[model samples]
Target: MTILNETATRTDRWTPVCSYTDLLPERGAAVLVGTMQVAVFRTFDGALYALGNFDPFSGAYVLSRGIVGTRGGEPTVASPMHKQVFSLVTGVCVDDPAVAVPTYPIRVTDGTVEVSVV
Candidate 1:
């Protein structure tokens, strides 16, 4: 998996996952990017985030089903299997900053939530 940074890079051919309207507020959506399973989230504030759906610790496919909350206003998601907390924006483990998760850059263009997989 890769954590692409569109803000610093170019992705003119990003793949579309879902309409921005399709995402549940404060919920995460599991999507496919060329066979890679991903968890794309729409925060309560309307911000979008994307990360690998697989939990590195438990090897579970539950990041999409994880809980959403904040710590001192930093948005986060908890792993359902072991309750590992990770920053939605950076995909960095809050409990242990050394741990990293691939965080993809996302955008909503014309109501579509698109992500770069290249």
Candidate 2:
């Protein structure tokens, strides 16, 4: 698993997992991230977001289906397995600020969505 709050190691070509158009608002899908699973999403406004797919509390692969919304202008997704909301930008759980998920560097190039898994 990728460690958070530590020195970040850079990698070449963050494997293309999914596309921006693939996500459905209020829904989510899982993709592979260098052996790790990542969830990429598209908001109602067509904005792209990425986050780890597993839920820390339940340890279930269910963060993708979490509701996508904003809290104080920060994009966030609420876990479907539970109600733990996570900021799409920071991946920090809204309900509990201490816990967070591994967020990847996401960018759109030529209509493709890519993430930095390392």
Candidate 3:
């Protein structure tokens, strides 16, 4: 595993989560990294995104079960519990900007999906 710190120097350290073939386009998958549950997504355009799986409104680990779509050109996922849409790139809740989830850096190397959690 590789660790990366968010600071003046933006360095990316990736940890393999799953195979790229395991993910479906425009869908989200729940993955466990350490004690955190991460929601990994593969967009229709072949873009990959990762965010915390916990939903702030419902306090449930169900972000991965949310619906994937775009709102005003920004890619987003709607929480399954309360339908709170969240930005996939920034993790900010669309309905309530103050509430947001943690977003992780993700990449696909070769045929595997990797996310930077540190």
Candidate 4:
């Protein structure tokens, strides 16, 4: 399992999860990296976001099955199990400020989606 060190510098290696074409607009897919299940999303505007696949409210690995949408112009995903909305960029829960998911740095290079689990 890869543990992310907050104090560590931003020199982590990016691992390719899937091809860009594998993702559809406003949808999410689950991918495994190390011991983590990550949810990857491609917005309608062709932007990508990655976050932890675990839904804190439901205590299930179902964030990838969430519905992608926007709240106050912020990209968000609503957990399919409990309907908790989370910000795609920051992973913050909109309804409950105390809850938040882990977010990963993601990018697209040469039509591939990559994420850093460091």
Candidate 5:
């Protein structure tokens, strides 16, 4: 008999990255998932977010090292190279709407943080 639930099956697509408490509030961490570099962030409100670690402005994988903050009530991270702010939720550049980065799906499971590239 199968005791697994639907949620458990869904979690198969999620890749565990780190513990929920490992992430400092308003800071970002970089993780590699299947050849993809992902930047994970945790807001002061205990919210988790993930975005591509590549910074379009500087053509560098330093988004994870950017400064975390907010803009217009939206969680944001500014590129450390050029200081371009990007929305953590949508991965859109707040300074330039025409340009945007990629966002990934992130979640917390049993105190562990997970990011899905697929």
Candidate 6:
């Protein structure tokens, strides 16, 4: 897992979290953006997503350890603690629409994965 440090370049509001190659397909990694704990995911098709690491259902900062998969074509991550699935695109709970986690805007510049925590 890569952490944001002095070496990472900041482009406007986006902060560099890790290199695109550092993330494995269908896996997640946790990184600290200021005081926020962000969970970064790379889908099997090479898509990238960023969500808040806190699991609302379990009250634990463990979303980074969730199982990555899909639901009706939507990329998702199932909370490891309670098995609550969340949409990687919108961060909405798949089982409970009213419940949701925060999603961050992410993009890759060159080969680095950057997320906007602003």
RMSD of 4: 5.0
The models' CA-based lDDT, in order, is: 0.82, 0.75, 0.86, 0.86, 0.84, 0.88
lDDT of 6 by residue, 1-118 (tens): 3323212233358788898999999999999998999999999888888899999998999999999999999999999999999999889999999999988878887889888877
Best by lDDT: 6
* Candidate 2 structure quality by residue, lDDT tens digits, 43-77: 76666667889999889988987888889998888
Any runs in candidate 1 off by more than 4 Å, and if so which? 1-6
The best candidate by TM-score is 4
lDDT-wise, the better of 1 and 2 is 1
Q: Which stretches of candidate 2 lie over 4 Å from their true place?
A: 1-11
- Considering only N, C-alpha and C atoms within 3 Å, which residue pairs clash in candidate 1? none
Q: What is the lDDT of residue 46 in candidate 4?
A: 82
Per-residue lDDT of candidate 5, residues 1-113 (tens digit): 11111132234577878988899998999999889999999888888888999999899999999999889999999999999999998889999999999887777767878
Taking all chains together, each candidate's TM-score versus the true structure is 0.89, 0.82, 0.89, 0.90, 0.89, 0.89
Model 4: per-residue Cα lDDT over 1-118, one tens digit each: 2222222343378788999889999999999988889999988888888899999998999999999999999999999998989999889999898999998877777777778888
Better of 1 and 2 by TM-score: 1
How far in Å is the alpha carbon of 5 misplaced in model 5?
A: 21
Q: Model 5 residue 37 lDDT?
A: 97
- Segments of candidate 3 deviating more than 4 angstroms: 1-12
> Cα deviation of 57 in candidate 3 (Å)?
0.4
> What TM-score does candidate 4 reach?
0.90
